[model samples]
Target: MDSKKSIHLLYAQYLANKISKDDLALLLDQLASMSTEELALLTAKFHSSEQISDLKNTEFNSQKTLAFIQDKIVVEEPRKRNKFTAWNTIIALAASISIFLLFKVIYQKDSSLFRATQDSSLSSISNQAYLSLILPSGETLHYSKDLQLLSNNSLALPTKDVKLNVLEKGQLAFEFSLEFIEKFKNKTYLIATGSQASCTIRLMDGTLVNMNGKSSIQLPTIFSKEFRTIALHGEAFFDVSHHKTWPFKISAKETEITVLGTSFNVKAYQSDSHVLTSLSSGSVALDNGTHQVKLTPGMEGYATKSKGEFNTRKISIQEIGMWRSGFFTFHEEPIIDIIQKLAQWYDIDDIQVVNDHRETFSGSLSKDKSLTQILKQLEKVSNSKFEITERRILIMR
Candidate 1:
């Protein structure tokens, strides 16, 4: 068979579970030679309504599927075999499955219910010692700093310990553990930090992300040759990897921040009125179709979700990133707003402002303090007093 038609037929047979051992090897050998456009077409095929419906209803068993694929693979001596059977198909199957799962992951990523129902072990805790790592194949791994390393390899460590190195000037460094690097190429991952916890992660492309409490980020499965992109929910500080040809872009709510190389903080909690993008260094452009704003170092761009409009202003870079340094820096910020942040950082669920008094706080408070201690400090500064009840905090005048 000619190469082009063989490529089509090979995929067709594999999809139909009719591929022979020889055909599998042939497809494997040609995978590296196939252009990205050609592979994109195959990925598109998996998105058809019929295929998508089947995938949604089917329970995918990766181990069973791999075992079946392995049984069909055979190695043959070059002198005794044809071109198709010169090498075993195991390597080819691994590559093929990686591509197939990459598409499948992107397909199911938008399901809010699926994201909400991750393993209970990862989500049940109100406070977490480590960040939750959601694998592209929908596995959850929890790692803490207490883990002891037994090997130099990232994956060979005894436990999944995500390490963070604090740097000068509010910058943090994090490297993906070995287990993660294995799936880094073709799969995207969602890293989530709990309400009482914050974490820093470094993407495969060297972009550093400081995820605040109750925040999550959807990292691109693959940083495309054309652009590097990520989607954010809640808040994060991004130290982007610069590429002159490939700009780094972050999509948060209705607003998008595009930068070639810059450090910025984005806040887009679902409950907030505006999406805030504050630049720490270099330059960033914020866009929401109807409006656009360019921000330089020590400036912030705010986009109102309701109006789809944007505005810019000068801001303090230290205030923008103080949360990473275990402090909440407020500058005449509303009392309710401060309470909301306190609730999120401390995992206090039933916080209510009983009085709608117009009071704003302007100061910095250490996050390491207890809830009562911080509340007492705030009360000493503002007109509000805190009343602690059973599992609730009431702010009254």
Candidate 2:
């Protein structure tokens, strides 16, 4: 057999947990000697094969295999030879497997493992620690003070000797200090939260906004007499003050939401495939130029960028602002999607899903919990296992 076919056979045996020690050594030797182009072709073949589909159900301990490969595979340095080593071969194999698993999970269809049911018992997870103020001039100001100060409804600014107060009902009243009023007036400001931070701000019109982690809201220092408009780039809960004549408008990617007065949640993250607007009270209209839909209390409207059309669904009113109270509520959400949310909240830098069964999850989790705690609960409810190393998280079945 050709070297390519031989390598494929060995890899298949390895996956089946049927490879002998001598065969494993021979496979590593062949992989280390192969060129980059040849390795790429092998990876492509692995990706297209049906063997990968059976990975999720395999009983082999991949963690132990990886550990053994790392510890046992060592190629002695040669005086005048190619640079490839056993370590390089192991890394390449590991990367190829990871890529295959991720692609399979993301694109797999007609698989029962993808189906998920709701679990009412699960709670939520936690967030990062910094908030920032970006001025229109491009200067970014970091809030370096203790976030706990906000709990007392007043934050003392050590840099400016001013008190930034959180008004009743969790509204961050920036207008309380004359210094802030003078500085922010007439200029546009972008309030941003870090990967593990959430913020609440009171707009000039008394509209309360609770911003989720890794989110931002851009607004002028003052609203125009005819309209109150803001642009959102992430998720937020809005409680708009009543204004019959002046309409509150929000531009979230392709969707534009118009409201006279209402309390609702807008999840418009650029990374998300859809812009979701869920209402808790009053009424709001969602338009994306191509289509328009009006939402009443307990209704949720969503639009995708690719389709540019609006769709509506019914949700519990209590689920509207669950994020504000440090909880995440999901309904038949994909596992990858849930991990993306957890990555944002925990400031995780890298994510890898291996041997994914394409499972979906539904439930609630408290944001106050640790990453380990959240993943433990998730493991109990699903067939996946989670591993964390530094800032990276790995999901496997």
Candidate 3:
């Protein structure tokens, strides 16, 4: 009559509904004393696909019993028990916490734990009121400004509202209230975003556009049409929400990307003569106002303005769109190209390439990292020497 064997028999009988109603109530009452680690183990076991399926396909009130069990799985640890449970309830508990901890160990031998999702009221919007974006070039810009940077666009504000601020030479922001959005229906709501380098925006339909530095997104004052649309100049990345009912469309330089649903990132900088569209999921068509090239996942379609031609090739997602993620993700990019990106993000007026073709580098870096940090990493990885002055950086390989 081993204690572990006796407990297993009791647990199995309880699962089989052989336990009485009073016994069930007593078990539920013991739940409040469980520890975080114990509860986490229980959660891991309860959320298993096999257990969930068993609970679902079973008959004879099994679903109710399972729900009841899951609800009682959350319990505060001994040290933090005072935070969640009443002191009276804590002392009156019949079962020892050790038994529960053993039960958890047996049920969740290998699964990991995750935090519980809290329920929220339905009145909230997904948008953030304020956010600071650091571009791949190292420019941290606050895109909260009046609608002044955008031509032919206007903003509506509350009576005593705080006017948004755009740091020294940063771009503008546009966050319209639902009411204002409704008022401007059909009319275009345009605004500039990104640092002297790049910026991003989420459309009404949940699609995101990364605005390469010095680009604008043209939107309807209010979205009423089926299509989510945008225009680009420099470069941009798009994780277009899959809207099978309507197409997500983007026009950049001389190229256009059209898809009903997909995960693709686009880059069309001014110095580059082409629009590079990299796909992550689904399919997209890259058109040069006349001819179009279809792209599959892992492939990038390059449409050049000079040749008026479309070329498709496979590329890594990190290599192209990491700019939106606040880092310069480069793959075989030349030193000159790296310098140009550094120039844009650091807001350097000019770059002197002491030795351009003699050197090149590759690596990932946080856009928020100071010039000194970036230079150090760059110098180390590229096997080059970096000399830093007040606002200029010199690289010698």
Candidate 4:
């Protein structure tokens, strides 16, 4: 049954003055999962309905329950119908207050919520956060979930210039030392760009780093032919400085790659539980803690959640790295999963279902298009309908 329809049925009974106390408690449980956007549209649709005021009378610990449910930041609380202290009890008792209050006691204790970690300390477990970064140079940088800092070699950065500093989270800026570069090969300089920014450092050793946005890199304000190396987090496109005798080492989120100067890209976001490394120009060996996979250009390596399950396979280069072009393209992705991607992109937290498993979809959807337009196209293909409320999308069957 549609939970919304069930809620309305219960509300209708209240308005008709025929509802027992238990049905009222059941409705409160349903309201807890309602997002702020859901509540606004709900109130708008029902404001003129006579059931509105009657439902207001349905009390949770009297006035306290009302205040809690109506609070702007209410978290979802699953409301299942109580098996006991329901209409059966109402019928057993001859319309007495004694039986009704006992029903409230039986129901209220279980629904009480104690928020253990408030917003400030919830970063570790929370998908949402108010992240900001500050530079040692006193500049502010916006933070992205996938941002990395790399320190290796740069034309301008004297090899391993330890003094280079990143001022903020999303800002890309690096410095090179001329002292190390004065005697180095190409006499190149280090560069830093912004979110989704790219840094291409042409070192004396002829190596490169394509820093993806929200990424940073530093180098030897000097260069060495013996060993070419750098560290990374977030994502970066790399074409290492080749040296047969000197191996280039790249490190990120508990994964490392040592190569004889090859070409590849690592999209290892610290926020991501797994690291995705794609070979682009040359062969590179990938490592998770215990397992390692070696890949030639055009192959990909994935380290799974379980420690021993590292997997390596080949993927289309264009599909995996399309975000560099400011878009995400999906192929053969499930309709529900597609909606989920949209939800995260728009920062939406509400996605309701028609509770069916057989529906799925295809076709290219734009990230820049409206949620309604995308959903509408999907609905047309699946021969289904959907309801949109502010940021939420509900599948209608």
Q: What Cα-based lDDT does every candidate model obtain?
A: 0.66, 0.67, 0.52, 0.51
lDDT of 3 by residue, 1-397 (tens): 6643544444444555454434444555444444556455454643454543343211112223334344444332224444235433433332323234333443343221100000011011111112332211122223333323222112332422223333333433345556544554444534444344454466657666666554445555444455666555446677777878888777665566789887777766555557778888889987664577898888998855544678778877546566776787666777767766766566444555566465546676788887678777776666567676765667676
Tens digit of per-residue lDDT, candidate 2, span 254-336: 67799999999999765678889999999999877568899999999887555467778899998887878788778788787
Over 61-86, each residue of candidate 4 has an lDDT whose tens digit, in order, gives: 32233444234113322334365644
1 or 3, which is superior by TM-score? 1
Q: Which ten residues in a row have the lowest lDDT in candidate 1?
A: 112-121
Clashes of each: 2, 10, 6, 21
Q: Write down the TM-score of every candidate.
A: 0.62, 0.60, 0.51, 0.43
Candidate 4, lDDT over the whole model: 0.51
User: How many backbone clashes are present in model 4?
Assistant: 21
Q: In model 4, which runs have C-alpha deviations exceeding 4 angstroms?
A: 1-207, 211-227, 317-320, 335-397
- Backbone clash total for model 3 is 6
| Model 1, CA-based lDDT | 0.66
Considering every candidate listed, which one attains the maximal TM-score?
1
- 1 against 2, candidate with superior TM-score: 1
**Top candidate (lDDT):** 2
* Comparing 1 and 4 on TM-score, the stronger one: 1
**Candidate rank order under TM-score:** 1, 2, 3, 4
